[model samples]
Target chain A: MIIGEQKPLDEIQGLLEDAEKVLVVGCGTCVTVCFAGGSREAQILSSSLRMSSKLNGHPQDVSDVTVQRQCEWEYLDEIEKEVAEADIILSLACGIGVQAMAKHFPEKWVVPGLNTTFLGIPVEQGIWEERCAACGDCVLGLTGGICPIARCSKSLLNGPCGGSEDGHCEIDPDIPCAWQLIYDRLTAMGREDNLLELQPPKNWQVSRDGGPRKIIREDLRLISDELES
Target chain B: MSGKDNGYLVGSHLEKMLRAGHFAVTGELGPPQSADPAVIHEKAALLKGYVDAVNITDNQTAIVRMSSIGAGTLVLQDGLEPVIQMTCRDRNRLAIQADLLGAYALGLRNLLCLTGDHQIFGNHPTAKNVYDMDSLQMVQMVTDMRDKAIFQCGDEFKGQTAKFLVGAAAAPFADPTPFRPLRLAKKVKAGANFIQTQLIYDIEAFAAYMEKVRELGLHEKAYILAGVGPLKSPGMAKYMKKNVPGILVPDEVIDRMLEAGKEWAGKKAADLSPEEKKARSKAWQTEGIQVCIDLIKEIQKIEGVAGIHIMAIEWEKAVKPIVEGAGLYPRPEVN
Candidate 1:
């Protein structure tokens, strides 16, 4: 659950004040679980915009449609008919969903309805917090399932930096020291020896630093050129 | 009286009672996103004579539904008071205030100001939010409209004066710090005449909450309608306990339902194979009805409870029975 808060309605209205025919689109993925943008949100926004427009006497023809997953091409295909009719597409998905909507419907203008916040989980009902960073690496085996990249202010790979005081981060007292939590968990599991092992600095090449990344599976690949020809 | 003036007076009286100690009941119905209005109309009709007012939720929880204004107009056309739920998740104050005025013109008198659920929780995650003003400020704006007949911090209204039964929501268990009562007070001071709280299950905790409300002098200031939604099934009970925010489901209530389960002997029937289906069906129906009646009874006992807002959702037909079972009758004269 990537925890995030909805942006104010006025800010969203401001972005598309000029749009005549508005299409409020929602994603059915990460942002939906986090309560930011999903099909439900898209519909709400579409209704709100329509009502707001009528109230203001600007009266734009506002419509709504939701894609199964805005991040994928297949889901975006479902709303191509609706997208074609609208002047602007207001996406209620996360950053990925919004970008995907933009990419799939290049002819229509796409506007984001939610502020993409952080990768987190609903720790309790109605409360969500950050949990992952998708740093393109997994060190949970060594750190007892906590990712320092997200919890640690410094994203320190080796260990806690000098900024840690009494097992709490110096930047914010409310935040627990990520390394301390890791240390405690490891010690509890009787794997304290794991921390003593020297680990090299994480290589950024495999992450977003390497630009757009792609994964290919030989078994899943389709031999299209020969068949199409 | 003009149809418009009658609507205004109805709204005004409701607002006055809301400011007083009178309990209020309000229910919500979502409008279809499309032009079809039959479903919205039918639901509004069923709730018309029962509730103090019906709320046509704009985009509750950010899920798209029918247009609230259109629904409000339909409700008004049917001679029922409609509480227009306006969320700031999709509009600025300029638009919000404008809608207030537009709703007023449409003969829609009641308004429930909300900040709206984050779009992320709905079907959309990447949607931009517009929080130009929160629910508090919106309440204040409505109050200002009533008193000055003008926009807050702006010029006077050039047209007929607009009045609204302004209300806001409070979630007692929403925050760890329990800011609901204090926030309710703030909304009152800002011009909120009534507060509709989130669904509550623990009467003891709610009674304790009322004690705090009395201490804060909010009991005397604004109408506080305890929100109650009947748990139709054991699954609903579990969902409310685990998922719904600011809800406190007591262990005793769960135990009672479980006991009811035993009396039906569904577990034993399940072992018999042939009786399993019948037993399962009987258990679900019995438990659902029992939970509904139990919640209403508990809520009726709480002090300082001005009234109860029963949210039956698609189960509007069960509302009358629940209210009657809880020993409440429609106070047609009150409204």
Candidate 2:
């Protein structure tokens, strides 16, 4: 799941300096689970902004709304009235959702209130670890289900470079050496020989290196003829 | 090279020594961070006759320096052989291949493949890294470019390939110690002609690693050069033993270095005058070279050991004394 953190109140207030009316939008999917862009967070953030403005002698009109999925166009369409009434639509979703609001509304100025961190799941009560780089090509099978592209500091293919110590990465002790984990798992499975084979240079074309990516599936698309039918 | 038994790959001095069954002696020469060519020339002069060939490091420790090939060309101009080090951390495959062509064109004969230190450890921590490929992939690519006359993209070179005596670094005591030897095997399988390991202070551990390397007959596949370095001071020794991962400096070695500064063992840093501090530092340095020389002699006795890669970064002056003390002076002249 995508993870994000709310922007600081000072920065958000600075972004809204010239705005008269503001709508604090919240996302219900990934950000909600991460407790960052959920409805409760948006309402709390909206109240804080109102109190901060009233305390500063410049009272502001600030309200909030939550969408089931802010990334999709239909959910954004549901907030058409609120979006049209506001001077700035502050998105509490990931970068994708913030752009979706601007693109769908066209005239509305959309600002991101949350910094999307990474594609990962909550590891514990309040901890999260990155699990995928979304590099487009996955080699987890060869690595015993561990993703080196996301976990290894250098994304080494034949790794656990000299930097690894005590089964942890050289950069941060909190991070486990992905290659060490792979080596242990593969060795336990009696598939240690799998590591002997060399993985060729990764073709990054399918990844972000090829620029903003799009997947067009003709089978899933609805053309004008199909819509008419 | 007689052109019959497949003689030297690049005919480099190091390759010739290994081919002639003489224990080769290689050393390192780190380029300065500035654009001054005199730094390269001065350091190259220190290592010219002390080592068979000197490895010009490529931004070692993620610190920016003169380009390895650029420094290597200057080393060549100084009448010394140079083994250029290339790391995957800085360049993509295209830039690496292009650099290989340029390095060869400038008369370089040896190459060392590395994964490079992380940018976070360098002066430019904010720099974006380009680990487009790892060291293994680099070794395979460089070897193919030399032997098959093809680029990493599989396109034919159409003319002369950049033939080099390819080398790679091995960390014998890195985490997951069971896999270190196997990693060396993978590098050897990828066509690395020689192997230089991370610096050693624990002979037991390194010898054990060599046992595994020998068990796989990787010693025959590629020449193995054990990495060695002077300690500089007891603080540096203790710091490495405690802080530097993958380096194993024993307590005894640390004790020896401490004993060198026995005259000021309990003296406070604030109490010592500048000259007294310098005198103590000189004593520590003298002992450090002795320790390194002792290590070289022991490492040479290991069954699979073929040479030593002395790394005296920023202390190139120590190489002469250490080499001479180890009875490796008057390096063999192989044509």
Candidate 3:
């Protein structure tokens, strides 16, 4: 799950403070799972804004709608009619959803309701810890399923940093040393030999450091000549 | 002023009397999941004249609940004082400010600001958790609203200034590692007029907690409402023990409940049948109500404790009986 937290109520309200007609759009994907953008949260926010607008004596016409996946074009198409009516779009989705909304409706103002935090999972009921960095590479297979890119405060792939002590990160005692956890998991799996393999320095070029990435499959392409009449 | 003059007493006087050892009763009402006025009115009416004030829960447990403003409005319309429970889960500062304005407009006066339960605890586990501002910031937000009619985000309102009897929550037992009273004192400094604590079972420990609150001189600055809940069943006791954070369950209380069962008595200490165990669990649940009431009586005697917030949890009907059984009566004027 993409674990995200909602922006402060005051911050979100400030984003749409000047709007007369506010449309809150929710996404039903990673953000929804993280509790940031979902139908329920969207409605609660809409009602809150409406109530606040009333309280301020500057009543707003607040409407709420949820797209199956705000990051997808097809899902955003559903809100074209509603988007035209809104003075401001308060997206309760994550960063991707907000960008997608802005992409589809370039002329309309869009504000984010959530602070995109991290790709994580619920460790237990009511607790979510970051677990992935989406570093544009696959390295977990060599690290006992723990992503050093996400958990190692410094994203060190080779070994524990000097700050690790007593299997706890020096920066935060609450955080377990990611390398230690990886070592223990690997040791339990009888794959301790993998630790001896010195990892090459990460290639930042293949990841986000390179220009925006793209993929092309010639087999999936349609011929333009055949499309023309 | 005599109690007969005005039905609704300002929370300050009530807290003073409560700290002086007068028993106090409070109740909670979970808002429904919609904007319909009738449902909100119905629930508020059920609690009217029974509870000192009906708590309008704000997106409790991150579940989709009605806005506190609407529910508080309904309670006010019904001639009952509404304690608006504002959570930092949903709104940013702008929305919080806006709601405070709306709440004052609706004539709702009391406020309980909470750093809400995370989303994973609710039905929608994937929901985004918002803690941009914690409970202390929320208290400051409301106080700012009341003091300047300006939101944290600089939005100005030309209306009657809000005067909320602000409250916050603390768990003395949960974060035992920290200085809990010190943390609570910070909330008081942030403009918390009172505090409604997490559910407490151990009076002796709570009394000790009260002494700490007194040491900080918080007893002079803020009212403290000790939270209490009557376990409806043995299953509920187990659920509370496992699920509710910051709550402690004394083993002796559970053992006493188990001992009260008819099937358990005269049966050998060893070798109890499965059927006997199930029957005993049922009997224990039946005895839990009385146990909680007795606990409340003991809690009322604790110094520096202002009142009790009875969280019946969908059992609002039993509130009157529990309050009466605990040797408390609604102020005559309120009735």
Candidate 4:
């Protein structure tokens, strides 16, 4: 899931400075699961902003609404009235949601209240770890299901560098060395021969290096002319 | 494609030393943090005529320093062979290959490919690292440049290709110690002409690792130059034992360093005079070199060991003494 964290209250307040009306729009998906930009957080933030503004002699009217999914236009359509009424629309969602709101309401100012961090899963209660780099090409089959592109500190492909020690990375003792994990799994499976072969230089062009990626499934798209009347 | 073209890859003295069946002794020369040619010249002078070659480091430990290529030119001017280190943390493939061409044009024949220390460990913690290619792929890319005359992108260039006696580093005692030898085999298969390992403080562990390496017969594929460094003081030994991973420093070695300071043992700092302090430092250094010398002798006995790579980290003065003490002086001429 796309995890995110709320920005500091002071920074968020600063971004909304001098605005006469503010709308705190929250998302009900990934951000909600992370407890960052859910409806409750938006309501709490709205109350705090109102109190802080009143104390500073500029009490701006604040309001909030939660949408099912902020990334899609259909979900954002439900909050058109709220967005049109506010001078500033603060999005309490991941980066994608904030951009969607801005695109949907092109004339209004939209700012992100949360920072989208990574594509990861919570390994334990209240703990999240990144699991994928979203690199277009995946080599999980060869590497024992662990992603070196996301796990290794250096993302080393061939093997662990000199910095790996005690099954941990040199960057931080907390981060497990990706290659060591891959080695262990592969060895246990008697697939150690896979590692002996050199992994050629990664084709980064398939990744972000090829620039903003897009997928066009010709079969999935329906031309308007072909749609039934 | 392991130098089958013959006539030597770069004909570097270090390469010739290995090719000539001589026990090579390579030294390290750390570039200064500033652009000072004198520092390079001074360090190279200390190592000149004492070892087969001098390795120029590329901002080792993430600390910014004068470039290895720039410093290596000075070492070359001072009548020494330099194995300029190129790390992947700072440059992408284009930048690395470009630098290799330029370094080769400047008479540098040896190259040590590395997956540079992470930026978090260096002075610039906020800097982004560019591990565009790991050390293994780097070795293959460089060898391809020399043997196949193609760039990492598989694009053939139209000029004299950058030919180098490609080298890579090995860390013998890193975790999953059992897999370290297999990792070394990958380097050999990647076309590395020589392998300079990380500092080896625990010989028994390194010997066992070498036994695994020997079982695979990797020693016959590439020259394995064991890395050895003199512990500057007991504090250094303790710090390395605690902080640096993959470096195994036995208690006995640390005890030797501690024993060197026995003269001032149990004395309060307030009671010790400046002269006594100086004397203690000198005593520790002498022991450090002696211990390094002793390690070289023990490492020499290991069957598959080809030579030793002495990294007198920031202690150039110790190189000559360690080399002489190890009976590695007058590095055999390989003409």
Each model's DockQ score: 0.02, 0.84, 0.02, 0.81
Candidate number of the best lDDT? 2
The list of candidate 4 runs beyond 4 A from truth reads A224-229, B1-6, B267-271
Fraction of native contacts under 8 Å reproduced by each candidate: 0.00, 0.79, 0.00, 0.81
lDDT of 4 by residue, A1-229 (tens): 9999999988998999899999999999999998899999999999999999999899989999999899999999999999889999999999999999999999999999998999999899899999999988999988999999999989888988888888899889899999999999999999999888899989999899889999877687786435855
lDDT of 3 by residue, B1-335 (tens): 11312322233333334444555567888887776788776766666766677787888877888787887777777877778898766775557877787777777778898866656557787765544465677787777676657766657756667767778888776532134676687678777877888888878788888988898899878778888887765556666665554677777666666566755666663667787767775676557767778888888788777778888767676677677777676643412
Error of 1 at A226 (Å): 69
lDDT (Cα, 0-100) at B69 in candidate 3:
80
lDDT of 2 by residue, B161-240 (tens): 89888999999989889999999989998889999999999998899999999999999889999999999999999898
**Alpha carbon lDDT of residue B163, candidate 1?**
75
Worst 10 residues of 4 chain B by lDDT: B1-10
Could you tell me the lDDT of residue A165 within candidate 4? 85
DockQ of 1: 0.02
After the best TM-score superposition of candidate 4, give how far the Cα of residue A71 lies from its true spot, in angstroms.
0.4
**Which TM-score values does chain B get in all models?**
0.86, 0.98, 0.84, 0.97
User: How high a TM-score does candidate 1 get?
Assistant: 0.57
Model 4: DockQ score: 0.81
Sort order, lDDT high to low:
2, 4, 3, 1
The reply for model 3, stretches above 4 Å from the true place, is A1-229, B1-22, B34-42, B154-157, B260-286, B332-335
Write the number of the candidate with greater lDDT, choosing between 1 and 3. Answer: 3
- Model 3 C-alpha lDDT versus the unseen true structure: 0.74
